[model samples]
Target: MKVADNLAQIQENIRQSCSNVGRSETDINIIGVTKYVTINRAKEALGAGVKNLGENRMEGFLKKYDEIGNDATWHFIGSLQSRKVKEIIANVDYIHSLDRKSLAKEINKRADRPISCFVQVNVSGEESKHGLSKEEVPSFIEKMANYPNVKVVGLMTMAPFLDDEAILRGIFRELRQLRDQIQAENWDYAPCDYLSMGMSNDYQIAVEEGATHIRIGSELVGPYDE
Candidate 1:
């Protein structure tokens, strides 16, 4: 199927998921993950009314940003290297993997303005994931008070690719709970309002659990054509 068709279907799914929980579909933001697709395919997503685009690597993001210009809101959704912070700091609107104090410091120094950041948490306790532990999230958000240039807009996590809905939902639920706990603190720089959990396979569960941003890849853009 074409990108437009895929996007339409995904949007419907999002709407239905929101309705299931008595939530407005507008509460969710579908970020089309265009990391592996070509510029033309990414444009197809834009033509389909998807204004948010995400890339996992710096090079690909820069290339797409050049080709797509300001037509979309860009999200850096991968493990960002501290050394590369200066290169992308001024470009993207959201950084979805702020996992360390060093990276936060670098972002503060490089960002032209306060960058909306999601403090990544490895809620599933996956050794392979690159984020702080659940126990570390509160302290980490507290530390963000010093990094004025980095605005903590939310929290992000990647659930293990599992078929069991119970397990996947647990991980997402944990992230949402953690987000709520942090938001209660009412930290000035960190609103902790958004939950950047879920992807192509598990966005519905994420939305039901209060996810404000869902990063969709293959289910929305499909595989790269060129």
Candidate 2:
């Protein structure tokens, strides 16, 4: 199926999800995860009205950014290495994996402007995930004040890939609550207004629980083809 068609379906699902929780679908930003597809397919996503595109790897992100330019809002949605920050910092509009002090320091040093970042949290306690543990998020965010160039716009997490809807909703809900707790503080550097949880497999659940940004990959742009 075409990207447009897939997008329309996803939009409808988002509408329903929002309606279920008395929230507005307009608040949800759909990030077309284009890391796996070709640049042309990424363009196809842009043609379909997906203005935000997400890439997990620096090389892939640089490639897509070269072709797409400012045509789309770019999101770096994977673990970022401190050394690679200088290479991609200027080009990316949002960094979704701001998990460590070293990476944050690099972004602060490399970026010419304050960067919008989501402090990645390993809410599910999965050893494989790259994020701060839930207990460590607050202090970590607090320390972020020193990194003047990085702004904590939200919190991000990847739930365990499972069929249990209850567990999925729990993880998403926790992230929302955590975001709210932080947002309430009204830190100039960490407003923490967005919840960057959810993905192709469980975005509807994420939406119902208060996800402002959902990263859809295979369901929206298809699986890895490179």
Candidate 3:
């Protein structure tokens, strides 16, 4: 299928997902992850009406940022290295893998303006996942209060690839619950209003469970022609 058609299908699903739960489709942002596609293909997603684009690597983001222009919002959705924060700090609009204070300090020092960030939590306690333990999130957010340049906009988590729908749903639910718990704190800096859960396989479930942002890659942009 064409990238445009793929995008249309995803959008329709997003609308239906929102309708099923009485949430407005506009409440959710579709981040067409372009980490695996060429810049030309990334532009195809933009032409198809994807306003948000996500890249997992600094080099890929920089290359695409230069080639794709500034018409779209850029999201850095990978585990960002603190040393490379300066490389992407000024370019990307959102960083979805903030799980530590050192990274936050770097972003605070490098970002010219406040940058939206999602505190990544390892909800499932998977050793391979690069996120702070769920137990550490509250203190983590509290410490973030000192980083004026980092806005605690949401929470993000990666569910292990599995076929069981119930498990995936639970993982998303955990992230949403964490977001709600944090948002309830009413911290001045941690306005934790969004849940950046879901990816290509489970975004619809994520939306139904109160996800404000979904990062979709192959489902929206597909692989590069190479």
Instruction: List TM-scores for all candidates, in order.
Output: 0.98, 0.98, 0.97
The alpha-carbon root-mean-square deviation between model 2 and the true structure, to one decimal in Å, is: 1.0
Model 1 collision count: 0
Residue pairs in collision within model 2:
none
lDDT score, candidate 1, position 144: 93
lDDT of 3 by residue, 1-226 (tens): 6788998899899999999999999899999989888888888889989999999999999999998768999999999999999898888999999999999999999999999999999988999899998889999999998999999999999888877889988989988887888988999888999899999998998899889999999888886633
Q: How does residue 159 of candidate 3 score in lDDT? A: 86
Cα deviation in Å at residue 30, candidate 1?
0.5
**Comparing candidate 1 with candidate 3, which one achieves the higher TM-score?**
1
Give the Cα error of residue 8 in candidate 3, in Å. Answer: 1.0
Angstrom error at residue 17, model 3: 1.6
| Candidate 2 accuracy as lDDT | 0.94
Candidate 3 local Cα displacement, residue 203, angstroms: 0.8
* lDDT value, residue 54 of candidate 1: 97
Q: Tell me the tens digit of each residue's lDDT in model 1 across 1-226.
A: 7888898898889889888999999989999999888999999999989999999999999999998888999999999999999888778999999999999999999987999999999998889999999999999899999988999999999999888899998999999889999999999899989999999889999999899999999998986663
